[model samples]
Target: MSVPLILTLLAGAATFIGAFLGVLGQKPSNRVLAFSLGFAAGIMLLISLMEMLPAALDTEGMSPVLGYGMFIIGLLGYFGLDRLLPHAHPQDLVQKRQQPLPGSIKRTAILLTLGISLHNFPEGIATFVTASSNLELGFGIALAVALHNIPEGLAVAGPVYAATGSKRTAIFLGRYLRHGGNFWRRAGVADFGQPGFANRYGGYHGSSRRYYGGALRR
Candidate 1:
């Protein structure tokens, strides 16, 4: 497999690490989780602003008007999706009253998995494109993505395990369903150009909205 594919796989696999932790009922301390999340968010922000956006704007024959326009569209698209989705934030589950109904927790896990899968699809696309263009940048992005995915895994698995008391089931759903259509979409990477304006800018804006939104909700 190509290095880019390998990076993508490794990043996606990070969800398993989180799933396992969640099944074991051991989460990273809040400080550790917060630091890791903040660091990853910072990396994504730097890459979006300093690397991806600039490179997209610098492409020969790329008009400045269209470049910024695409970035704005991406930003707007993220917000639109955020508002429209029926996602259950991980924090929402965590903050629920103690000993909630098992059926409710199961339903919440399913909904959360659906929401996380939607988010992961675009993230997969962005990771593959970034890695294909620049191996170094791709590695950085993969690491950032992997770091955040841990909590996502925990979010999905924790509730499922609580509802069913089955580690195998929880881990299976958390690992596989979390990726959803992303695995199939990986093949489409060949159809894309080398990390262009639309992909990078959109991914950047999406990542910003996801991270910032989570922060605001907390």
Candidate 2:
């Protein structure tokens, strides 16, 4: 299998680690979670600004207006989607009465899972493109993605376990449902990278840089 595919899968699989933490009733200290997330954000910011954006503009025939324009679009798109998604913190979901209503809890879990799953599709694409274009940068992007995804899994699984009182269901839905979207998107990108399309088109690297700038606007 390709290195890009392997990295994408490994990154997506980090969600399982968070799922296990959720089912086991263990939460990371807030300080540690904050530090980890901050580190991941730093990595993405540096790569996108220093590496991906520069590389994108350097591509032959790429004008400054187009490159910067796409970057701005990416930033705007990220914020737009962020506002549309139904996002609730884990504390918000579980900090209510000791015995919250089961139906409400389950509904929250399902919405969280759907929102996260939908979000993962774009992440998968960015991860795949970054890795395929530059293996070194790909690893960094994958690590950053994996770091954030762990907490996402915990967010999904914790509420499910609380509502259903079943570890198996919580883990399955949290790990697979959230990771499933990522896996399929990566697979689809992999097909695009096959000899037939990427090679014939010969614009893979340029396209990768453009997509990376926009898709990973964070």
Candidate 3:
């Protein structure tokens, strides 16, 4: 098979494995989730800075100004999506209670999964494009993307399991974590965190979630 196809398949399979482990691994420890997410963040950060950006700069006849502009645009675009959506990362949720209200929990879980999936799409594209151009670069992108996706899988599974107390629900959430509309809905929850009494009513955990989420956001 062609390199692109091979890379795509490998990436997809890695994502599936991560999701499976997140969903079925019988009450995954918080530390495991945190470390997985952290590792993923490190991989992505390294690849983006050390590989993808430099490779983009190397594109023949591609002006440094244009490349920088595109890089800025990509950063902004990712930020917008993260801010405007209820994206999930391993550290974004905390055990506020033994059980959150059933409906609220379900909604949050769905939103989290959607956010993860939206985030994953661009990663998939990046892997595809980089691999199409250069095999080594593509491999690096795939590794980074795979690392990042693991925590996303955990993010999706954790809340779903919490809400429904059902492994199936958690797995299902993990499966659909990338769906767009779900992210939009979760974004509404995030907006509730802004000024006004709504922020109090909103589900704001302590800074741990923020730290982990910020790491993934990077």
Candidate 4:
């Protein structure tokens, strides 16, 4: 019904697109995956520097000094997160037999799923709160969020599907169900814009349970 809710759903649903791609017989080339990831990163950087920073600087009572400090802190935080998270590349997940992964692919999939799920929860809250404050701003944030989410989904599904060779199981466990975590987290924040964390614990946890349990095995 609300604009923010609609944007959240559409953006969250974009994961299905990536999941669809990953479930196909052939994975995308390294060049294409690299390009997509590059575009997503650029979208996020531009949104932060061009849109979010300027908007923050313009807010009433926000000092230039404080605004610049906040921008610096944000940059520091982004770089910090970039260093910490070991994001997967879809190119690394193909069924190529020439060279193989060093570790357990299933374990890699699970760990990546955990990392992505945890990272996405806060992002869900951020997108909801930002959009609720400014409708137009919310759309941009959602788009940026969705842009990155697609690659993330493809990264997860491509490997798991290659290993498991089960489309239903891979789609359910890898991308589709993982994406539900984003939706419910964002939905909780949107529903309780004032205080967000309380309901989200229950909601995202439920989604995770369903995700793990519902990945119908072939």
Q: How many backbone clashes does candidate 1 have?
A: 0
Encode model 1's per-residue lDDT on 1-218: one tens digit a residue.
78887787777778778788888888777777788889888887776666666766666556667666666666666676677655653454452235645587788788777777766655666667667667897788789889988878888887788787778889888767545635643644544423464466545433332332232122
The list of candidate 4 runs beyond 4 A from truth reads 96-103, 175-177, 187-192, 195-218
**Candidate 4 global CA lDDT score:** 0.60
Better of 1 and 4 by lDDT: 1
lDDT of 2: 0.76
What lDDT score is found at residue 192 in candidate 4? Answer: 55
If the candidates were sorted by their TM-score against the true structure, best first, what order would they fall in?
2, 1, 4, 3
- Candidate 2 residue runs with Cα over 4 Å from true position: 90-100, 190-192, 200-204
* lDDT digits (tens) for residues 31-66 of candidate 4: 777776677667666655565556656655556676
lDDT of 4 at 142: 76
TM-score of candidate 4 on Cα atoms, chains taken together: 0.72
lDDT of 3 by residue, 117-155 (tens): 666555555555456556786786667666665656666
Screening candidate 4 with a backbone cut-off below 3 angstroms (N, C-alpha, C), the clashing residue pairs are: none
For all candidates in order, the CA lDDT equals 0.66, 0.76, 0.56, 0.60
RMSD of each: 5.5, 2.2, 12.9, 9.4
On lDDT, the stronger of 2 and 4 is 2
Pairs of residues clashing in candidate 2: none
Q: For each of the candidates, give the backbone clash count.
A: 0, 0, 3, 0
